[model samples]
Target: MVKVILFDLDGTLLPMDTDAFINTYLSKLAPSVAEIVDPDRFVKALLTGTEAMIRSKDREKTNEQVFEEAFLPLIELKKEAIWPALDHFYDNVFPTFSYLSKPSPLSRKIVEEAGNQGYRLAVATNPLFPRTAIHHRLQWADVADIPFDLVTVYEESTYTKPHAEYYMEICSRLDVRPEDCIMVGNDIQEDMVASEIGMKTFLVEGYVIDRGEPHYRIDDRGTLEALFRKLQRKEGIFAEK
Candidate 1:
């Protein structure tokens, strides 16, 4: 039984160029934190922190902790100062990032259709952003109204996807086996890697990126919708007895 359907936010549901999304994100993040420290240096330290987290042995640490360790000494400021920047990001700067990600009409239709079919939903987006940021992005995609059983946020997630443990945690929390889940996303490396854990994988081809490696093919979104329609009629995607 395909009990859970997990979808990535960026590039899958919300359409955007990956680079443009980050540039708009940083442009807005910089001005907001200018009052607290050197903006350029601050962003640099933040990047360093991000890299550190990628290599971190202690996956239990939140991105905030990873960030603060690299950023704190440079600013010589209290932890309280970082809050303003984050607050600004969640309330103001983050909204502006929405301009970079446009809503797709098919996004809502598929999500709504899937929900009606009784599949548990999850936004299995990479948990690099806080919950607020992730939530707002969902709203931007107009799929915010669609209830998700679990929205993985960096603060709460111990592991990022592409790591088998990440999918394991989601299955454990949702009480579903990896075999009962389908991870849908645009990135071949990040999203399709879920297959390694035995979850079904769907690559949304709307925004394809060829990274000079073996391509994990995704049946197009239209094909997916049709497949769901067939499922609704009890004609499952795979042959059934």
Candidate 2:
């Protein structure tokens, strides 16, 4: 029996103009730290920190720790100085970009559908951002109100996606076997990689992202409505083939 459904936040559930969001994020981020570091250098260092998190396979340090070590020294300030600025950015400026996200009712529909079917849910987004940042995006997706068994955030997550260990870590936290879970997302490479650990994969076609490297099997692919239909089947999509 499939007891859990892992959902990707950005393109899979939330319809986003990724470029627009990133541009806006960078545009705002530079200003947030302009007082402490050269705006251009800050952006460069921030990207480095983010890349460090993505490349990291270190289980001993949280993504947040990895990011801090990589980011702080570049600014020539203690974490205490630059930290509040990023926090302030997420609190004061980040939500304004919610307008960039096209409203998608399907995001909520899928979550509610899975919940009604008794499958546990997770907001399995890449744990690259702080919880508040993720929470804001979740709100923009219109599915923040529902309780999820896990909402992977950088402060706590040791691994980032596209890495099987990341999926395994989530499975470990939820105390569920990978085979008894479904990883649902739009990215062919990043999200579908959950299959490496025996999890079923579902590609959400509404906002498909196929990087074409490290290809993996997806058990199903369709719109969120089709997923709702799958949940309604007599034996459900979990039936062994």
C-alpha lDDT of residue 93 in model 1: 62
* Each prediction's whole-model lDDT (CA): 0.74, 0.88
Q: Count the backbone clashes (under 3 Å) in each candidate.
A: 0, 0
TM-score of each: 0.87, 0.95
lDDT of 2: 0.88
User: In model 2, where do residues sit more than 4 Å from their true spots?
Assistant: 234-241
Write one digit per residue (lDDT tens) for candidate 2, span 1-241.
7899999988878877677889989998898788888999999889999999999999999999999999888877899878888889899999999988876787787788789878899989999999999999998988889999999999999999899999999999999999889999989999999999999998888778877687999888888777766766623454534
Residue lDDT tens for model 1, 1-241: 7888898888888877887888877877877788777789878876776666555546667655766676677667777867776776788767866667768787887787678878899999887777888889899889887888999987787677566777888999999999888887888877777888787776666675457555453433433455455545645332233
